[model samples]
Target: MGRFRPGAETDRFGIRIAASGNGVHVTLCRPGRRPCIWLHLATAGTVADKATVDDRPEIAALARRAPRLEARALECVRNDRVLFHDLDAALEPGQVLQVEGPNGCGKTSLLRILCGLSLPGAGEVYWGDAPLPEVRAEYYEALAYVGHRHGVKGELTPIENLRFHRALAGGTPDRVPGDALAHLGLEGFEDVPCRTLSEGQRRRVALARLLMTRRPLWILDEPLTALDRSGVAVVEGLIRDHARSGGMVMITTHQAIRLEGCVLGRLRLGG
Candidate 1:
């Protein structure tokens, strides 16, 4: 590990990756409290060098950064119809990959494959320098996925629903559930059961998970669905903040999302 200089150009979270002779090394440095942690990515198999699983988001964050995500030659076929062919894409820290096309272009299908929810007809997905199969568990741990379904239980309140999500993940919560709800404009409505909330509110409730959890890679499908003007802006702000914090997001939307300073790479399917 190199020396940590104050006011240094460290990453927002002080992440630095350097390649070594046999493997790659990752270092996540904080200002002065914890020493810089040096972890190596093995050329094969599970990472022998892993931080102990703890209930702290920082520790988990450190563990997830070394491996970047990549998808290559991805092809999908459904019932003899070619959804997409030989799709290739990559997303690194502080970047966004926007998958856009007309309806029935397989935008959602590609996202599902990227997040490991479904398998591709043919292609390879890499996590860091390793094939995804070798690091499946680790990859999923570092990923956050939001699809068309709100995934909110109608019987649960916004707070309860978010709490349930956090519990299922079993990791440290980034923010209090109530705080996440409030941040998404659900302050007075937190206690109300989700069934009573409108479609937009339910979507907001689901979006709140992005605030309450920390994950390096976000794969979203129709993220702005059912959102109003302000809600769309809120979602955009979240994407910007996440990228600025050294996280990567892959999104699919119908309308163009223009972020003044953020560079968006587009993947348009079905020419």
Candidate 2:
């Protein structure tokens, strides 16, 4: 709805079109009524008005798919000591990599570096042979980072939290809240305030965002910290589906997760 304008058209479909910052906008025009009907269509990659109705669905489908991850490390130094000396790792499409180590190790730090939220002290992170800084925006557009803290606000309901996250991330919240809550087994409590929910339920809300975003790379720090068996299964299934859809995942957790057909690698940080 940001900066949109309507226009008349004489095309075969007899439908008027609108222009918006998000993407192409479509509207139906009648003889007398002043543009009684309107529809807004947004696509992630490109914009086009000539697309058919069927094409719109296809574009939406593509947007739900995840992108690939290509992170490499050149070197890393911290406190005059080498943290990751010439660390170089590449995760192919549809693969999952785990960073395992004891507490106080650099697992979280490395994840932050990969996410480009923090720069490595003396190393280079890359997204397909290109430095992360050069493509930081692109990385942000393609990645979703879930840190130790569940990012849900206590005052907001589960649905409201997800809606806020989707809006901030530039994603359509039309189905995100519903889909995420349902997937995380919070359908009945979707409207309940997060503060009223148990710790596990709060974690569920954060985990639900994984299904809603189109981001490919998921960097989770202790993603399963406060979940029961069922909750863990839900997250595990989501991870499998994410990898199957050509997405990349980097996780740091004490719990062991086993997935077939998933290439697993580990980085032991501390002694």
Candidate 3:
């Protein structure tokens, strides 16, 4: 059995809990009908605990009440015409939000607004409880963005680019740059300048930064563009893993995204 210490987190019932492993053991208490949860290791021959309220989809949705990113009544206008308006949304941990719409429907514009690169014509974007401007430094530290234009520097090799990215992040890297490159299927091409690589390979280089940064929030615009089937699968896996680990993602893509084991929400623009 895994031991659980007191954690700062509390649910609606004010249950204090700490977690360390895969299994959850809950003991029901009488009188007030409160429940105590125990953290358990997944050992052989141990009867796996049945799904509890925390595992139920409906309860999980209610439990995700804290917003990491929120947009309230956001309106976008280009060429003096409103593209989208009255858009209120929030991103919580372990959630993947897919922004979907037709061409010129302001999907990219919405992403830019959420990223704080572009402002909405009306309304506001907030990180946690405060507006984005007030928490720019802290928010950016947790943000990783990939746009339609591949951000890879053409003159730099994949390894060099990833190293530069790590330096900019200013922390101990989660993995070596070469390892990230190879994981993205750029094994032999790690030393070659990004300028000489194919467009798909360049896209892979930009995507590899996501692995190295390990940021909690990812804002991706057309992340699957110019990639083969295998590359697309790799990105899907990355997004799924990130969400499973309690990371949030905001992505705009025309392709259907197949994900499992996390809450997925779709926001349609210009509809």
Best by TM-score: 1
TM-score for each candidate, following the candidate numbering: 0.79, 0.71, 0.77
- In terms of lDDT, the poorest run of 10 residues in model 3 is 23-32
- Candidate 2 lands at a TM-score of 0.71
Q: For candidate 2, give the lDDT of residue 210.
A: 76
lDDT values, one for every candidate: 0.76, 0.69, 0.77
Compose the digit string of candidate 3's lDDT tens values, residues 194-264: 99999999999999999887577999999999889999999999999888756799999998778877689
Output the lDDT of residue 223, model 3: 93
Candidate 3 residue 54 C-alpha distance from true site, Å: 8.6
Arrange candidates, best TM-score first: 1, 3, 2
List RMSD in Å for every model shown.
8.6, 10.5, 8.8
| Model 3 regions more than 4 Å off | 1-67
lDDT leaderboard ranking: 3, 1, 2
lDDT of 1: 0.76
For each predicted model, how many residue pairs clash, with residues at least 3 apart or on different chains?
Answer: 0, 0, 0
Residue lDDT tens for model 2, 1-271: 0112233442221244544566655554432346534456565536554444344554333322233455455445667766665566676656788888887667877887888877777667777557888888767866788988769899999988988888777733325588778988888998889999999999889988877666667888888888898988888888887776557788888986867666666766664
